[model samples]
Target: MGNIVSCCSLDENKKYLNDDEILETFSNSEINEFKKRLKNNIQIVVLLQDGTKLPCNLQANFQEKTLCISCHQKVKNKND
Candidate 1:
């Protein structure tokens, strides 16, 4: 399917935000939440090799290969 995600807002990054920024009713570990998402999002640029896909502007690549112009181009196109 298309990135229908764009049509439906996904708040993939409400973690970094402090408690004051989000809805009330706290009860769990925000860091843990971030850790879960970190599993699959390791970008090639801006160097976040910790494997944590934090709210960044770069793109993700897990091919065990280095980032190249082609990868950058793909990320650009995806945003377009």
Candidate 2:
């Protein structure tokens, strides 16, 4: 699995993002690049502003070059 190259904080009340709101965090070019480099299943991670890292299964549409974080569990922060 590839590790995260960068991090961005998305401060929102919604813990889970719906399919339609997948592009909220990334741009078209970013998504395209991601899809192009995706050889197989990869680990999807969501990092909160409070330093909580949540692992989740993200749905990717290669043809559409889109990704969706439908759901994720709130895991305790390692620092805690």
lDDT of each: 0.44, 0.69
Clashing residue pairs found in predicted model 1: none
TM-score of 1: 0.21
On lDDT, the leading prediction is: 2
Q: Write one digit per residue (lDDT tens) for candidate 2, span 17-77.
A: 7887777788989987876555344567778788777786666676887776644575664
* Candidate 2 pairs with clashing backbones: none
Query: Would you estimate the TM-scores of all the predictions?
Result: 0.21, 0.35
- Model 1 lDDT tens row, 1-80: 55564656657864565667563445467755644445445444443355533344332243654332223332222233
CA lDDT for candidate 2: 0.69
